[model samples]
Target: MRRVVITGAGTINALGASVAETLEAMREGRCGIGRLDIRDVDRLTVQIGAQVRDYDEAAHFNRQQIALYDRFTQFALLAADEAIAQSGLTFEGPLAARAGVVMGTSGGGLNTQDENYRAVYEDGKNRVHPFVVPKLMNNAATSHVSMQHNLKGPSFTVATACASSNHAMGQAFQMIRAGMTDVMVTGGTEAMLCFGGVKAWEGLRVMSKDACRPFSATRNGMVQGEGAGMFVFEEYEHARARGAEILAEVAGFAMSSDASDIVMPSKQGASRAIAGAVSDAGIPLESVGYINAHGTGTAANDKTECAAVADVFGHHANDLMISSTKSMHGHLIGGTGAVELLACLMALRDGVVAPTIGYEEPDPECALDVVPNEAREARVDVALSNAFAFGGLNAVLALKRA
Candidate 1:
């Protein structure tokens, strides 16, 4: 079988603008959740979120392009710049033809759509902006990254709610394994931190009032966040030939669907996905040293995820170093998987397991060791990232130290 390795990682989250800053915040158990500050929201019930405070669209693009692209694309383009720089794999050689891009997004251009509706309906404007269609398209992230890097092979976007990023990375892994592509930049981005987006999520009635407290019995629900995570995946030999810094290997990936409910997730879906990933990885359950859980800090998510992990690994659950970076960065929804995958790669490469902050007390249902409050030094070889979204979608990815 072919081996795929990560050459670079980049992420911009509520905690930080880059991976190093974000990793440091996670190590210190920093909490990004706070009172919403994007706009005046005193009238809203769910008033807190993980907003990236300093992302200036004006700095990222010219006024013309800004009018053409949404805030979500802006985030993705910024993240891709960092990822491409870190990869050192510019379109210089044969690697160009062998490279691709896959990005995931949940609420692509939703903020723009809301504004357009308000302009036409509420404000009674007759005409919309010329870039409305392009800005509102879901594939803008992938296209933007591909165009920037000049990648022409197998470029696309994946949208499966929060599972979008996981699916994107998993598919990239498969493409490289199948010899269809040699290198791929894969991840997710979301910028739904707008008034319209927040109200849309509030309709779900699953957001926390205070803070996102994953694995805590008193946890109200998940918190919304916006950011982008990017990774460069290359064939092992190809990366070595080009002298790229190999961070981790894509060991395996698995995806499953609940086929049950659109809103409520199922433990069975998570359990099967984990088991299938273990099987596909061709590794024993005992070999998974760490798990970056989908601990969304919601009642339904934390409980079912704990059960699924326990069922898949049995007694190993107590020993495995598990955590949810969401505690510090909030939930990125569709972009969560990509950021979580970065956490896993960092865990495997640096041997520093990040903490699950905001875990004041443990929930009985979530009895697993959540590596709470402080980062720990642990020798880990294999790590797993789990991302479960609405519509019964679930995706899991495994990474091994390269």
Candidate 2:
């Protein structure tokens, strides 16, 4: 099998607009969650979110492009642009034909849908935008990325809730490793902080009113976030031949399903995925020094994930440092794993462990070294990023220093 490596990374999230900016924020242990600035904020019970502050869509897109591209698609394109530019890859000839795109998004054009629904239902409008269907499709982000980058090979979107990005990236890694594609533009995007999006999540009663404090005794619930993360996954040899700057190696990936609950998480299933990823990487449990946990700041997810890690790593679990970036960036839902993967890359590339910000008091159930409230400098050779989503879907990716 061909070895895979990450050549480039990009993101536009609550933390920052570029990979450099985001990593700086992570190093500083900054908190991005705050009072959301969106339409109809007065109507929602949950008013806080990690919104992309000071975003100027007009600065990034023209009139026609803005008309066709939804907010999620815009974010994907911006991030993809940065990744492709950083990679120094101009897809053409066979590379263009072999390169592809795979992205994940839970609500594709949620903002568009919210606007149209309000116009039609609340205002009693008879007609909607002609491009509403195209804009709101779940595959719109993937399709747009493919079109923009000229990725003519296999392209698709994954929609496994919070695990969507991890699953999509896992598939991309497999395709490259299997020699089906030499390169893949893979990641995820989400712009679901609109009125309808918050309303739907509010019904679940799992949203925090102010902050997201993952793995903390004072934690209440998760705060919603919006953003996109894009990365360039290339064959190791191909990258080396071109003298590309490798960020980190995609060592292994595994996914599993609980087959039990919808909203609740299962420790057994999460452990299987976590253990499977390490086994797939052919790395011993002790080699992993850090983990970007899927600590959702919820009672069920935090405890369940801690138990799963304890079960998988056993005694070694206590030795490894684990932290949740969700507390800083909030939860981006489908785009979360992609963003959280940044923490893993930081561990391998810079030896900097991103902190589980907002952690005030420790919970007995989650008694691991969470790197709480402050960033830490450590020699991390291998790191894992965990994404256990709704409906019991779990995906874990293991990374090694390049």
Candidate 3:
């Protein structure tokens, strides 16, 4: 099996617009969740989100491109541009045929969908944009990424709710490890902070209006965010041969389904995925120094994930450093795991553990070293990224320092 390594990473989120900026924010334990500025804000019960403030589409795309690309697609393209540029790989000849894209987005072009829905239903419009169908499809970002990068290999989109990014990246890692593809442009994108998007989530009654305080007893609920995180996964030897700057090694990945509930999380299923990832990586549980937890700041999710980790690692669980970056970036839904993976990379590469901000009161149920309210400097060799999504889907990725 070919080893997989991450050669480059890029992101545009509430924290920042690039990997460096995002990491800096993480180090400072900054809170990006704030009052959202979207259309019809007065109508939403939940008015707070980690929106990409001051984003002008005209600055990034021309008139035609702006018309064709939804906000999610635009974010994906920008992140991909940064990732591919940092990777320093030109997709041509054999490489072009071997490289591909796999993007994860639950609500592809949701902003577009929201706009068109309002037009036809509320505004009583007869016609909509010609590109509405293409823009709103779940695979739009993946298709556009493939076309832009000239990748002729396998390309698809995954939509397992919050676990979408982790599942998509896990598939990309498996493809490369099985020697089926030499490289893959894999990540996730989401821009669902629009009026319709927030209104829909408001029905779930799980959204926090002010802040997301994961693992804290004072936690209310998750705050939605919009962003994208992109990475270049390359064969280990291919990257080494070209003298590429390796970011981290994709050691192992595992995914599982609860088969138990749709809206609630299952500890057994999450433990299976977490344990499976470590076993697949051939690393002992003690070797894992940090975990980027899927702590959604919800009553059900926070305690469930903590119990799962406790069940998987036993006594070692108490010793491990675990933090939820969602406290800082809000929950990006389908694009979350990709952004959270950046926290793992920072831990392994820079020995900096991101904090779970907004943590005021600690819950005994989630009694672990959450590194609450402040970043910590600790040497970490291996880290795990956890993504437990709606419908009982759980995905975990093990990453090692390069």
Per-residue lDDT over 141-252 for candidate 1, one digit per residue giving the tens place of the 0 to 100 score: 8887888788988988999998999999999999999999998999999988877888878888998888888888888899988999999888899889878888888999
- Between candidates 1 and 2, name the one with more favorable lDDT: 2
Worst 10 residues of 1 by lDDT: 36-45
| Local accuracy of candidate 3 as per-residue lDDT tens digits, 20-66 | 99999999999888898989999999999999888899999999888
Worst 10 residues of 2 by lDDT: 61-70
Q: What is the C-alpha lDDT of each candidate?
A: 0.88, 0.94, 0.94
Cα shift from native, residue 382, model 1 (Å)? 0.8
lDDT of 3 at 263: 93
TM-score of 2: 0.99
Q: Candidates 1 and 3: which is better by TM-score?
A: 3
TM-score of 1: 0.97
Query: What CA RMSD would candidate 3 show?
Result: 0.6
